[model samples]
Target chain A: MMRLRLVTALLASAAAFVAVSAHADNLVTKDRVGPADAPKSFTLRLTNDGPTSTDPVWAEGYQKLFSEFIQRHPGWRIDLERMSDNIGQEQARMLEQAKSGNGPDCAAVDSFVLALFKGANVLKPLDEYFTKEEVADLFPFIREGITGPDGKIYAWWWNTDLRVLYRNKEIVPDAPKDWAELKAAALASKEKGGEGVLFNGGRWEGTTFDWLANFWAQGGKLVDDKGKPIFAEGENREKFLKAVNYFKDLVDSGAAPKRVATIVNYDEFNAAAAAGTAALFIGGNWQYGQLKNTLEPEEFAKWTFSEIPGPTADQRSTGTGGWTFGAFSNDPAKVAMCAAVVKEIYAGPGNALQQQLPTAAALYGKYDVFKTEANETFAKALVNGQARPGVPIYPEISNQIQIMMGDVLSGTKTPEAALDAANTAVQAAFARL
Target chain B: MPTTTAAAMGAAQRRVAGPSLARRIEANPFTWLVPVAVMLGVFYLYPILDVFRLGLTNASLVGSDERYTIVTLQAMFENPALLDILKTTAVFTIASVVGQQAFGLAIALLVMRGERRKLKGMVALRTLVLVAWVIPGIANGLIWQMLFSEAPFGAINSVLRMMHVSPVAWLSDPNIAMLSAVISNVWRGTAFSMIVFYAALKAIDPTLYEAASVDGAGHLQKLRFITLPQLRAAILVNSILVTIQTLNTFDAIISLTGGGPGRATEVLSLFTFNTVFRNYDLAGGSVLSVLMLVISLVLALFYASFMPRREVSE
Candidate 1:
């Protein structure tokens, strides 16, 4: 009789615990900036660089805003964790956690990596939480990039970056207007005891981005509009070969560093430019701000941005890439809260303007507070920028490009053979896709 | 007469037979091992079974398929890059283990021979080496990365320039990245071998060496015939441990190089990681991991089988 009573008591407590948990899951904080009161108070597990005051000044502003948000939502809590800077390692950790039936409610993912997460089904679709009107407010390119081929927006984005040629105005009074002129200028710079141009050729996504866009601007397409690999064909293959040859010449002539094979990313290139070792570099808008903040004002002013020279005299092109916010939970109310937060962070009235302008000013000392002036010009150039291929197989294709470029830079493989091999690998990737 | 004879026979048998099986076990005192046997069954056996089950399933980061097939194995083979990574893994594991053993044994011998006053310095050095081993692998990787940074202002380049040597791209060049990773691993691993060897050396009999010296056996002959033979068991154990540790190393390579400059230093583990997380090919990655597991098991078996069987005793 005593054992039966103990068992009954245990059952009662288990039932009570379940009831309390359900109740807690349904409780919502009403102080948010959205119309409807969400019926849940979610603990969103987000990955950010730790809560520190050492971030760039603009990042500090965002942090302050985030803190204010926490204060406003008394019933809600965001449990943020600092993730490793290595994207590959972080993804592996997240994937391992997810396999154990526990995953973060949200994550900050790079735009290029969205497909990786989506293919693994680690991302939760944001469509149910957001309306069509809300989706329309985001930039079309960003929206398109975040949405899967199945038409679900798996992630959200705020920050945008694009690659442009940064030139030393003191060294070159007039920047090169086209590919031919750029080559000549680089050679001349080398003869004058300066590096012609600097960019990464290390095997990574960055190298692929720089190489593919340059190849594209020269009328070389790796894949056709129908998503069929075209680089193995007659004219396209020849164009790719020619472009690689030109890149090789630049390296061989000491116009670009032979150590390009060692440059893993834009960070190294940025450091070089800051030290006055490189005369020209290809980098993003964020780099301009980085240089302004890290280098002295006098040295920083010597730098100015220009379009990446293209094949034709008048044509120029650059590569656009960015980071995005992603939801990883399927709870409706939590998803709604996250969607609202993203809207506030990215598309709300003054967020983008505030992020771009003051950050540009305080960090880089380059201010165009009015969007109509220099900011508008910068935005126009970015709008014309080409994004890396939106295909799910892009990583593999990117690897092929990096390998080919590394071979070219290292003088291991001829430009024609490297392009041919890259073309073959890309074709194989597309076939699998 | 018959009853008296039977009684006498029974008494004689009882005297000769020591005890029954249960009584013998109780008297012998080894019956206490039952709890240890139960603990091993509960802890070790259960986990091994669970892992084996997981390995056989189609479970992945994505949902699992109901059917089981050799599809995963096939995918592992289809990836042409796996061979290069496996080759790198072999080179790193072998070089690191061999280097650690040689250096560790030498240091252990020196520490054994040094005077008591100088032993403190050796102990302190050993402690410092242990500190490197105790540091998390991720931290070690980052510290090495700072040392190998290709830029002029990087630590290694700065030192090289000061020495009037051209700066080397330690992590960037394919030829150097693997070597850099091996060096970092060796630095962290040699301490473990040293500790093991030092313990083995401490347990050696001083009387045997004294007797050998009295018989006019020289120092080189003593090391070759006596010291080395005495430490054989410890050497075997340390080599096996270091081999396993070095073979499974992924964090150092990932943190230091990210297996880049065209996948120059990508070991097998990193390749499996890229397959599952980066490429989202779960089955393929699992097959690769299973293959790596098989390789490790085979290596363990080989080590066990080939280890010196003759036990040395004074």
Candidate 2:
């Protein structure tokens, strides 16, 4: 009854908004434009790469949690604003807000972007807020990723989405264990009259994530601790070349679609999978949502996911990409509250969606998705999952690498030339750093 | 009427009143354009000058830091991809602008001719062509992607299957990516030129065509002589305007190809966006923006030089 009233109030305000003005500015947000009703209100406005989903349960959870927090500290409010879903735009906004020394107490920063925030000195270290035990409970690599060189934790990751091998059980009914087997499976799936294997081969950071995951699996190093290009010299070049060559081979082979170069991001890949055209999609595990949401029951049953196979046996690897809640403030009082909010939303057993592997670390087995054998395999894969280079210059490095991946995938440049060219560019980027 | 002469009375009144506001405005036309000139200076010229200032420094989208450097400009010139990207931008701008003008004029002429003949479908056809133009860039990209994406599932592929022709990779291969982008863009952008040309064609005196027809001139000859001559102003204006628009085409290409198939269609605008926003290099992006400004200015001067000068009637 309470939830229904809130929903009704929201809908009524929305209708009023539409009636009052046909303008889009008023249409998007339910929050007030300026000033709080009370003096003690902490306007913890936030923005992210995606809008807050309207899942009532998830929202209700946050609302209840927020009300409780407000009740405990009397006369306080949280005013969150969403800027954009674009990473680069959001990063700029976050930095600008940080420079102003106000805005949301903090925001949910993507894992790859923590380095940028840290570099900009916008991130406030979380050392004083969270206890040592809480810190230890988090994934070590994640901890390492956020921790600056000065032993200060700049951010805490909320979730992770890894590149997993998804295939149709109806065609080629079995999962591939290694790189060779995965290729053979692709060939077999093609033979079965399916559209065969598909990768997120489009030009963007998505391509870089997919490419780097495979490279790590093949024992190719992207950078050292100092964020220098490792493949710029000697034997590493040949190893890195193999990764692009694999993409080239995938396209060259009849297994992958001739138009694999245009496969793009998850949505494009998901459409093919939903249409039953693409039998295999090597992409993020988050596609589970689309599979469940978009596909028919019978179709959903045929789809299953497994580890992204490595070049050698027992050499599984995947890359974890997800968003994290990070704060940027110099004030200790605001900093403390930021930590509390981050922990309350992302830490421990709280919201079901937030409890997932991508958002949080603990209580994975408790969730049905986590309990599944496939996800159990994903969890195991996470143990060896490669984290992206957490450095200020990583975005520059990734940009050049994405271009190289595009070059190799589109057959504009051979793998050797493309990879070599990317190495030189990356070397230049590192030199700047 | 009681005055020594009405002309003498009017001349005395004119001398007493000096010049009326309207007469003064008519005497110096550019005087009325002062607000517009000021607005252009503030909104347009200032930003270009600001970009130059930024290009000379290292001020970025981050914290209050005392950092200014000329190394960004040096590196931009030194970058190997600069030449190739500029070449791509040139190809894209020229092809897209020329294509937009040609298709737009043809569509406009066809529609105008049809309208003159009292054709029923002309209105609907004009409205239908604008569907591509009116749709948002992101939506247009998505719609085109669904149509041209891959084989079997894509709309084009389904048609290809019917015709027994092999599927075309619309956005994948570098050999075809720029052409694909141009085609997609031409569909969305040509309507602007069409609208302009349609209005221009409508404004032309019909008696000129009638005169040409009576002189034993064919339809093609009339078009070549009267139509072409009259439309040159629209053509020049649209060419410069569309050239800038196409050169600065970021959203459509970003949403569709993303300067991809390995930078095959990486125009300067997209490259600048990627440099600043994506790569987090503000100084470098400013230099590129300055370069884009120079390119547009050159085109502006070139187009303005050919613009017909108004005769001083006074």
DockQ of each: 0.24, 0.51
Tell me the spans in candidate 2 whose CA falls farther than 4 Å from its real position.
A1-29, A32-36, A43-51, A54-69, A100-103, A348-351, A358-361, A365-369, A372-374, B1-42, B60-66, B312-314
Clashing pairs in 2: A49-A85, A158-A359, A158-A360, A159-A358, A159-A359, A160-A358
**Cα lDDT tens digits for candidate 2, A138-208:** 77777888788899888877677688888888886888887778888898887777777888676677878
The DockQ-derived docking category for candidate 1 is: acceptable
lDDT of 1 by residue, A1-433 (tens): 9999999999999999997645443332222221134334554443442132236553445554555554455555565555656675576567656545576666667667665566667777888867776577555677777787799888876556677778888887677877777778777766766767887777566777876666777666666666576775888877777767777787787678666766666777678877677778777666776787778999888888777887775656677776666777777666766776666544332234343421121222323343444455556666556766655566666777777777677665777777776766556545434
List, residue by residue over B87-182, the lDDT tens digit for candidate 1. Answer: 888888898999899888887887777733455587777788789889888888878987887665679889999999999878756778779988
Question: What is the Å distance of residue A206 in model 1 from its true position?
Answer: 2.2
- Superposed by TM-score, candidate 2 places the C-alpha of residue A59 at a distance from the truth, in angstroms, of 4.7
lDDT of 2 at B95: 88
* lDDT: worst 10-residue window of model 2 chain A: A26-35
Q: Candidate 1, TM-score vs. the true structure? A: 0.79
**Model 1, residue B300: C-alpha shift (Å):** 1.9
TM-score each candidate.
0.79, 0.88
